[model samples]
Target: MAQTPLPDHPMRYALANELHARPFPVLKAPCRAMYLAIKKVENAAERDRSEDLAHLEALLDRYGASRPAPNADQYSGKLGRGFLKWEMHTEFVTYTLFATEPHSEPFSPDLFNLFPRDWLADAPGRIVTSCVVNVETVEPEDREDYMNRNFPGWFVPESLTASAVTEDTAVVVGDFQIDEHGHMRFAVLAHPDITDSRLGRIVQRVLEVETYKSMAMLTLPTARKVSGTVAHLDRELAENAAGMARESNEAAEVLRRLLTMTAEIEALSSATAFRFGAFEAYEAIVMHRISALRERRIGDHQLLSEFMMRRFDPAMRTCRSSKGRLAELSGRAERAANLLRTRVDVANQEQNVEILKAMDRRAALQLRLQETVEGLSVVAISYYAVNLAAGLLAPIGYKLGLDKTHVVALLTVPVVIAVWLGVRRLKHTLTDGEDGHG
Candidate 1:
């Protein structure tokens, strides 16, 4: 008999397997890495996906490497002298290449020669950032001499931050400067005892720290651009809000202005929303990576953590402050709009009250006119009824030897009283039924 299992959800396997995706590279000491992040002028999410795929395919074909499956967001494969890992992100695509061979010179341009010049030139998007990372294995005793010799050549000693990380198994150093090739430089000195996996994690963290830090700073310019627009909106909102107190007629105009401001703020918010969120997220990632370094100071020299905090913390703070300001301004604008709307509503209510008062006056006039018409109707009906009675009673009066005028005089009061009572009773009956239904 065949075994039957319970039905599985469509995404069960994929969701469960996601944790293993993008495993860290196993990098031994004495390895070299060239990391490149590419981004289009428009966001990667908005750019044509086919274009990115085609670019990757072209690059892989040149290296005799198989292309990624369709719609795959990332791929890792061997190239000429190194293996390349490509990942497509929301706003950019990153290519990380690693080679086991170390360059003799610390900041050699020959390291970038692994990439074909023509292929790099034809890349789909501009390079947002690129870095050359060299990991060297050092004996624990020779570490100080290694830094003293290399620090002056590659980094500014005055501003150098070198520290032991991963329980002093490795020491990483960088001055965070762009070199002549327009590439940032990072180097890792690991002990021979460190495992390849731990070294890989350290290398990955360093690269990520640099990448996210660069990505996070891109938002500062956008923040500055919107700051002026927000200030102008704030002043306009304040003026419009103040106008609401002056006159009821101005309420409509104030409401219109408030709506315009709301639209403007919303538009700005929509435009910058993604950037703000990305910056915050990337900033957090940078912090996390720095923390993962577990850096300890080397001989009074600042560590990477301290250097990052001193330089990057201020920019991050500015971004945070700008975001908060935008939110506050938006909230203030919304409240002003609500206030203006309430004022307009109150004005409308007051106008309606005046209209009701006019209607009441008209209703009172109509009631008085109706009463006058009723009185005239009673007179007319009485006159006609008395005439008819006079005609009928004339014969009887002649028989009884009484006058025609006296019969009419006697019947006039009763007829008038009867018609008035009948009209009043009819009106009362209608009103009573209406009241009962209500």
Candidate 2:
């Protein structure tokens, strides 16, 4: 669509810019969805609002056709196309995310920074989208019928009664009845600020209201997959418990087989390669999918919180219910992801411990061998020193004493014994130090 300039009015700009916001809330890609709240109709083609009053009255049918139409100022047709027509109204809070639509890159939020918050949103990505509007020419009395017709068998967020939540009820007759414009309006009037996502919520609220006519289908394949994984894990836990409880001999055999299989699974999945393989990868995929789904709902909730004002409506209850459900689902997803993450951490730690133990054992063996070699070297040194001493004494003989041969032989024997003992002590000391250090 070609860009068109709006009137030079702050309110108009606010409505237009907010509705056409870019980079959507969740998807980083061009927006794939959007919502719009119809404000007042300005002017119809080729006629001033006043000049078109006759036709407008006929079209709106606010008062009976047999009845007289009210003054132009009192109604849209009587007043013209510029009537202040609105299903939702805002007094204090302004509209945000009034509409969303996908656009080309050159014009997409990805390319243009549309909001002040985009400074943060741009760092990541966003998804923006739009709906295909089905314009129909229908009678004015067909508003409610049209809603039920278009959205058949659909949940109406607006229809979420107080009794559904707290059994509360109030009977407030509508005083602001339709004038002579012959036009129809919504009975479920929600103040714009009252809604969580004033603009977007209106779209969804309308979706619910018109579900019988225009049902919006949602795709949750990823959500389903994660849910399936959770269920599967639940089953596995039950099976493990049942296997542990079995007492029959055959059951005992089965338990043994189960234990062996579990060990094999651990072995096969224990490798770094396997951790990076399909099983771990899919687990990660499921975690990511769950996170994304939760995030989308969270974004919706946040949008609602910001957009919703002081007005309390039935839609608010429905929105709260939806948000609560989303929170619960998110908690479940987080728990599952955390379980997998913890398992991964434990597996990695165990691998490291095993490696350290292996290194310890190998180092001990190496040190023992080294000590044996060093001990042998010390003994050889001591033996050689003893022989040298004996040789020196042999020349001197026993002249200094009584019997020279006996002195040389006995002296050598005592010297050899002392040296051998000293050498053994030195080897023992060396081995002790090595063992201590190792």
Candidate 3:
């Protein structure tokens, strides 16, 4: 009987398969691994990924191995007598070459030659970190003697970190220092009973810890580079804020400077945000990998985590402190900007109020002058009106036996009052029309 088909999501299989895509490489004891991580110094996250793929393809061509699927982020396959694993990450890529046979001379540089000099030179990005990890099987009885004979010569005593990990499944040792060959060195002495898969995980974890530590510390130089600028800005901000309290300091000038300072702070924040964020993420990975090691101290020497605490932790703290200071300074700048803007606005409002008061005074003076002019105009109009009336009334006064002076006196007061009343009415009407329009 045929079963009914069920609808499935387009990404169902791909998403599920992704979980197992990059399985840890299983390796037997007495093996050597050459690990290399590459990243472009600038805009690494945005670099063309096809170039990375192309570089991988070029290497694969040399071995006559089959190519990885199009747009694959990782690949693992046999190359010559050993194996090659390639993986692409957000901002970097890594290649690991594993050999089953350990070199007689421990920490030998010969295994790294598998990556041809010409091929490495033509890589899409520069090497961020590269390391040689030598793995060996050590009997419980011989472990102490092995360390006595080799550890001192292989690593610096003061900086060396050695610890038993995974309940004594293996012991890992490293100095976290670049050797003369420009490669970090790590040694994993696996217990005779350790399985190949367990050994592989241990080696991978060691490499991851070192790789992330290196990546995380890259942000330290950036933090140091910007420290002087941050200090200068902080001082300027304090002075400007203090000046805000002084009456002699112009609010407008101070506001301008504050705006400039705020812009600079914002620019600095923008520039450093990505690097700081990356640092935090890489730091977390480093710590997590170290924890996964489940390290126990060997004798009185430091554990890997202890070394990180004494050395790496302070660098991480410095970056964190720098980030915090930038944030605090940015906030201070914003607050100062807001206060200065308010002060400037209040000053402008006061100036506007004074201008309005001056306008009101000028309007009052003009009104008074206009009233006096109107009174003089009324007198002038009434003078002409009284003279004409007197001329006409004289004849009539003659019939009643009155003199020209009497006619003039009789008309003057009436004409003057009539002209004044008319002028007042016209002025009131114009004022009323203006008020209605308004």
Q: If both were scored by lDDT, which would come out higher, candidate 2 or candidate 3? A: 3
Q: Write the per-residue lDDT of candidate 1 for residues 152-220, one digit (tens) a residue.
A: 888766667788998999988888888888888888999999999999999889988988898899988
Candidate 3 lDDT, tens digit per residue, 195-287?
A: 889899999999899888988998999888778788999899989988998985488999999999999989999999999999999999999
lDDT of candidate model 3 versus the reference: 0.92
Give me the runs in candidate 3 sitting further than 4 Å from their true place.
Answer: 1-14
Which 10 consecutive residues of model 1 have the lowest summed lDDT? 1-10
The Cα error of candidate 3 at residue 345, in Å, is: 1.3
Summing lDDT over every window of 10 consecutive residues in candidate 3, give the lowest-scoring window: 1-10
Query: Which ten residues in a row are the worst by lDDT in model 2?
Result: 163-172
TM-score of each: 0.88, 0.30, 0.95
Each candidate's number of clashing pairs is 0, 35, 0
Clashing pairs in 3: none
- Name the TM-score of candidate 3: 0.95
Best-performing candidate as measured by lDDT: 3
